[model samples]
Target: MKLASFRSSIESEIRLGIIVDDVIIDMESWGIEHDLDLPSTMLEFIDLGPAAVKAVSETLKNIDARSLVATSIPLSSAIITAPIPAPRKNIFGIGLNYTEHVAESARTLDTSKELPQQCVIFSKPPTTVIGPGDSIKHNDQVTKQMDWEGELAVIMGKKATHVSKENALDYVFGYTIINDISARDCRRSGQWIVSKGQDTFAPMGPYVITTDELTDPHNLQIITKVNGVEKQNGNTKFMLFNVNDIIEDISEVISLEAGDIIATGTPAGVGAGREPQEFMWPGDVVEITIDKLGTLKNYIVKA
Candidate 1:
């Protein structure tokens, strides 16, 4: 089931809801209707684990879409917040997981720094996260070379440590879209934090799709479009290191907690890899989409 965090136009508080077709069925409302007390926030649901999802599934199956109060409110009537707005740890992201992206970055930089035997990991501060349809704040003073990297982000369901690749996927709760916006100029200065941790840099979600719905995680088609032109087009099948490997590798060092996000990595095409380099500027709309999952669109705005 697709889960979302939204606030109605008349309400000031954010509430969790289950997505049914085009409408959102508020969990609290469902609980009131059925005399059940379930979680009311996305993070709360994440903490509740399978029980929360099962409850939502059961509740949705019994309720009609027309009965939801959210039906009268258009999706745009409420703002979509990050699935886990404030995660427990820094958001981890992998670099060059796709062979083509590895090759392209290698060609652009020194070829000597090529593929590695293990995953190359980096962290994006929780402060960088923004919801879908949020504006990406482009600070022209700090960075003139702002770029985008579309990646599939995996949300952990349960706490795990020293997990094996064989069972890594079992710990996943769901998946979401993340546009890993970067500042190429800041990155060239030998620091990734400034480049990656800007406010609104991490635009994630339309909704978090449960792992059970995605039968084959590695077979999905991933695409990114800037304005209206397709920029990055690739498949998870081309990933040099698959999801299970990433989970296993990461779990070996740090304990994976529920709500912690892991961005698998981006595909070949990136603005930094293009001829003359195409960087994001004010008014640029970037749309990142993955098969089975949904689209995450954000507009770039001058800070």
Candidate 2:
């Protein structure tokens, strides 16, 4: 099932809904009217476990067609927000998870730095998340080098700790697209939180697709574009540390809850890794698309 978080044309409240073909039906409203138990937010809905999945599927399958149309609103008529509007925990990210990106970084940053042998983890506060088509803001007072990292984001369905790679995918709820925007100048030294955790740096969503719909996460194509020109074109098969590896490694020490997002990291070809280096400026549009998962588009703007 494809799910989205949206609001009416005039409202600011975010509500969960199901995307039927091209149209989006307000699931919360339908559940309430039909006397079916349903959570209003995506995070809470996910916490309900397999029962919630069954409920959502049955609701969509049995709802009145005419009533659904009458009460439903066109997707273009509403505002789409990040799937997890209020992430209870910081968004987890991996750095240099692709060999090509690692090689590029070594050449651009430091030739002496050694290749990574373990998972490189980072995080961004929930405030950084913006939705598709939202404007990405950069503060000149903060950082002049604003870059983009197109990634495949995984949404967890249940609490996991010490899970093995062979069974890590079982904890996954769904997948979505995220552009991990970075403020390259913010991290003068030390860990990369400040450089990566800036507001509007995490443009996610369009929709979250359940794993049942996507059986193979490791064999998808990932493409990134700036102003309609291709910048990064890679495949998931090249990931240095696959999704299962990251999940098992992280969960072995830290507990991952339902709704927690793991941005599996970006591939090579980011602006920082290019000749003469090209960073984002105001009025620039950035888009990231993954096979089956859908496209996530956002624009760059000034503060």
Candidate 3:
């Protein structure tokens, strides 16, 4: 099921809900209807695991659309906070999982530094995460070349360590869309922290979709459009290192807890790879869509 976070108005508290068709079924309301004690905070639900998800699924199945409150809230209701508003740890992201992206990034530097036998991992601070429809703060003074990397992010369902490729996907709770926004200049400085961890750089979720509904994770199409122009387009089938390998590689080192997100990297056609280079500017709207996982759109504004 598609899960989302939304606020009715600026004065309203952020709420977690499941998106059924065009309607937002508030989790709290569902909890009240079913007599289940709902999570008071977003962080609490992240730890709720399968039981919470099952409860949500069952609740949605029983609710009648006519009986629910249909307030007609706009997509930009108030602010869409990250589905997991505050994760316990920083998010783990992979770089150059798509072969074309690897080749494009390699040309600027040494070609020898191209492909790795293993997944190249990096971390984005939890603070950088924002929800779909949120504005991406473009700090002009620090970065003139801001780019968007549309990726399919895997959300871990259970704690995992030393997981094998066969059992890696079994541990996945769901999937979501992540726009791995980057500052090209900061990234070229040898350290990725500043380039990736800027505030509001990471745009994740309109909802987290459970794995049961998404049967074939590798067969989805991923696309990114900037200001209505299609830019990045590719499928998960092209990934150099698939999802299972990534889990095995990372699990060998650090233990992945529930709610920890793993961004599986983006495809080719980044701004930096263009002929003259086309980067994000103020007022640019980036829309990222992954088949089955719904679309996530965000606007870029001057910091």
Candidate 4:
């Protein structure tokens, strides 16, 4: 199921829903009508774990699409928000996980050419997150070189610590799309918090596809475009350190709880890696599409 967090209007409270045939079946409304225990927010639903998912599945099995459409709101009428509008903590980010991306970074950013033996991890504060169609703030005083990195993000379903690669995936809740917006010139002493953790720097969500629906996340195609021009096109199959490696590595040090997000890094063709160096300016629209996961689109705007 494609799960989302949205509101009927800009001033309305956020609610959780399931997207079906481009319509949003308001879970709270449905639950109230049917006397089912369903959550109103994405985080609350995720924390409810498999029981909540099972309840949704069972309900869907008994209902017809017509009933769902009749009671649901048109997706166009809903104000879609980030699947998890406010994460419990900072989002985990992997750096240089793709072979080609690493090479490109080395050439343009003067970084190491060889791939790391382990996952190179970082974090972006929750303040960076914004929903689809939200504006990516472009503060001139903060950064002049604004770039995009389209990546597949993993959402953890359960608490995991020291998990093995073989069992890492068992703890996954689902996957979603994330545009890792960055301010190239804001890096301070190799740290990314200032560069990538700025407000509205992480635009995420069309919706989250549950693990059962998106069975093979490691082989999906990822593409990014700016102003209708293709800038980055790569596949998840090329990830040097795949999802399992990342989960296991991170879990060894820090426990990953339910609803925690980990962006699995991007492929090559970032603006900073180009020969002439390209950067996004105000009014530029960026769209990132990943197989199984829907498109996450946002526009750049002056702060």
Candidate 5:
């Protein structure tokens, strides 16, 4: 099922919605009309787990637009928000997890680092996340070297601890697109927290697809475009450590609760990794798309 968080122009309230082709079913108002209490926010819906999903599924299956009394509207008329607009915790990220991207980033230094023997992880503050069509902050004085990292992000459905690669996929709720927008200049020293956690750096969503919708998470065509030009064209199949490995590795240390986000690493074609180097400027548009998951697009604007 394709799910979303959106605000209706009439009510102007953030609410949970389920997508059905060209229209979005407003769950919050629908519950009031039908007298069936439903989740109002994406996080609440996720926290409710399978039951919430089942309820929405059943509603969609039985719902007939021709005789409906629920609040349904065209998708184009709603203001879409990140599937998980405000996460409970900072977003977790995997860095240098892609062999090709690792190789490109390693060229600037003489560290002679081989392929990572273990998972390299980092976190981005929740404040960094914005929905698709939102504007990315380009603070010229703060960070002149802004770049984009298109990635497929995973959303956890259950509380996971010490899980194995074999069962990691079972814990996933769904997937979405994330433009891991970066401030290269903020890579001050070797830490990536601040560099990647700046406000409006994580432009995610289009909508979250339930795990059942995607046939294979590990094998999807992921692409990134800057101002209508494709710059990074790669597949998820090339990742050095796939999604299963990422889940197991993190869970081994701490529990991953429901509603948590995990952004799988990006491919090799980042601006900073280019020979002459490239960076985003004001008014530039960045878009990221993963098969099954919808495309996430955002524009750069002066902070």
Candidate 6:
């Protein structure tokens, strides 16, 4: 099911919903009307693990079209928010995990040309996250070289520590799209916190698609466009380190909690990697799309 966190255009309260085609079935309203004990928010629902999935499944099965229309909000009219608006901790990011991206980084930026033997990890603070249709701050004072990296983000369902690659996927709650926006010049001291962790740097959501729906995460297509011009076009199959490798590698060192997000690296064709380096400017719009996972669109605005 396509699960989402959204707000009604007429209200400020954030609510969870299930997307059926273009309409959003307000889970909170449905639960209340049916007397089902459903969690109020996406985070709470994720923490419930399989039980929550089961509950939602049952809800989908029992919900009829007439009832759906009465309680549902038009997805086009709702304000889609980040699947986890305020993450419990920084989001885990993988760097140079795509062979072509590694090569591009080596040519345009100060990144290693050699492929990583293990996952290269970094963290993006929760403040960096914004939902679909939001704006990405192009603060010239902060960064003159603003770039985009389209990636697949993983959402964990439960706590996982020292999990094996074979079992790593068992902890996943769902998958979502993330535009890992970066400030190319801010990789000072070879660190990304200042470069990639700025507010509005991460454009995520549209909604989260549960694991059962998208069984093969690595086979999806990831594309990014700037102002309607295609900039980055690649596929998840190009990932140097797959999702399982990333989860197992990270879990060996740090515990991954429920609702924790991991941006599983991006494919090639970043602006910085072009023949003449390209960057986003105020008024620019970026749209990232991944197969199975819907497109996430954001506008670049002056900060």
- The list of candidate 6 runs beyond 4 A from truth reads none
Query: What are the RMSDs of all candidates, in order?
Result: 2.0, 1.6, 2.3, 1.2, 1.8, 1.2
Q: Which digits, one per residue and each the tens of the lDDT, describe model 2 over residues 1-303?
A: 888999876456788888887678787777777787787789988998866786677767776778677657887787888999789999999998888899888877653356677789999999999998899997888888899899999999999999999999999989999999987777756578999998888999989998767767998899999999999999999998899999999998899999899999999999888998888999899999999878899988888
Error of 1 at 30 (Å): 0.8
What does candidate 1's lDDT look like per residue over 1-303, in tens digits? 888888775367878877776667677767777777777787778888877777767766777555676333556566778777777788998887888888877766443356767998888999899988888998889999888899989999999899999999989989888888988788744557777888888989889888766746898888999998999999988888899999999999999998899988999899988887788999999999899778999999989
Candidate that scores best on lDDT: 4
Considering only N, C-alpha and C atoms within 3 Å, which residue pairs clash in candidate 4? none
Ranking by lDDT: 4, 6, 2, 5, 1, 3
Which runs of model 4 end up more than 4 angstroms from their true locations? 65-70
> In candidate 2, which residue pairs get closer than 3 Å at backbone N, Cα or C atoms, i.e. clash?
none
- Candidate 5 stretches with Cα past 4 Å from truth are 32-35, 66-69, 109-113
lDDT (Cα, tens digit) per residue for candidate 4, span 124-237: 999999999999999998899999999999999999999999998888989999999989999899888899999999999989998877877899999999999999999999
Measured by C-alpha RMSD in angstroms, how accurate is candidate 5? 1.8
What does candidate 3's lDDT look like per residue over 1-303, in tens digits? Answer: 876777876688888776667666666666776678887455566578878777767766787755466423434443566788667789999987888888877765233345778888899998899988789999899999899999999989889899999999988888989999988888654667788889998999877788767756898899999999999999998888888889989999999988899999999989987777889999999999999887899999999
lDDT of 2 at 187: 77
Give the C-alpha lDDT of model 2.
0.87
Better of 3 and 6 by lDDT: 6
User: Clashing residue pairs in candidate 6, if any?
Assistant: none
lDDT of 6 by residue, 167-208 (tens): 989999999999999999999889888999999998899889
Query: How close to the true structure is residue 296 of candidate 6, measured as C-alpha lDDT?
Result: 93
Model 1, TM vs. native: 0.94
TM-score of each: 0.94, 0.95, 0.92, 0.97, 0.94, 0.97
